[model samples]
Target: MIDIDIRPAVPADAGAVLDFWKTAAEGTSISDDVAGVTRLVQRDPGALLLAESDGVLVGTVIAGWDGWRASLYRLAVHPSRRRQGLSRALLDAAEERFVALGGRRGDAMVLEANEPAHHAWAAAGYRREDHWRRWTKPLA
Candidate 1:
């Protein structure tokens, strides 16, 4: 097992987390704008967890709960750190935090075509309930 430390993400962690996000978002529908990420980190500092190895941020998962349901997003692990179970550890930590915050259920939206994500979610005990055909009307 890789030696990693999981901690609540602070504003200072934005840059490192963004680096992981850039790589993870490739070939996927998930997109996170810098300003948006900044706001999110600020809004709920503890909702963002950073996984560090040798004092370097290598993984991240953002979770939130609003008294009813909890949700997880932006779960990314550095390519070099993949397949080491760090992502699972991070997800588990996030779920624990949400549950402690009174979350009764958890949810996440993954691209329908992302098999890896589906598998990961399933492996982590998340089950799909409903499917929706999303539509986007871009205003250019």
Candidate 2:
């Protein structure tokens, strides 16, 4: 097992994180760009969590807490680094952050079609809320 270091993303890490997501993440979001990520880092520095090994990026997860709800997003692991506990490590860090911030529960956004991700989430003890549907309109 490699020594994985999990930490909050800094402003300088935005570009690399974007590139990592393009390869590691299953799908892209409107806020996956450099500008959007930079804005996120500027606003909430500890919201974006990253996992690295020997300075190379391996995984990422966003634990967003807005006083009431704790939302998790962008959980991704490098293709070459999957099934090695990277995702679990990232989630553990994210959950710890949320708990520290007085967050009661955590919600994750998992794609309906991503079966692998679904299994992973289940393994992490997160179950899908079949009663809820996501509705959104792009601002751009």
What number of clashing residue pairs does each candidate have, in the order they appear?
0, 0
How well is each residue in 1-140 modelled by candidate 1, as lDDT tens digits? 77999998777666667776777643433335566567777887788888898898888887976567687877788878778898799988998998788887778756677777788889889898775454787553
Per TM-score, the best of the predicted structures is 2
lDDT of each: 0.77, 0.92
| Backbone clashes in model 2, listed as residue pairs | none
Tens digits of per-residue lDDT, candidate 2, 29-95, equal 8887889998888888899999999999999999988899999999999999999999999998998
TM-score of 1: 0.84
Q: Residue pairs in steric clash, candidate 1?
A: none
- What's the TM-score of each model vs. the native? 0.84, 0.97
In candidate 1, residue 71 scores what lDDT? Answer: 79
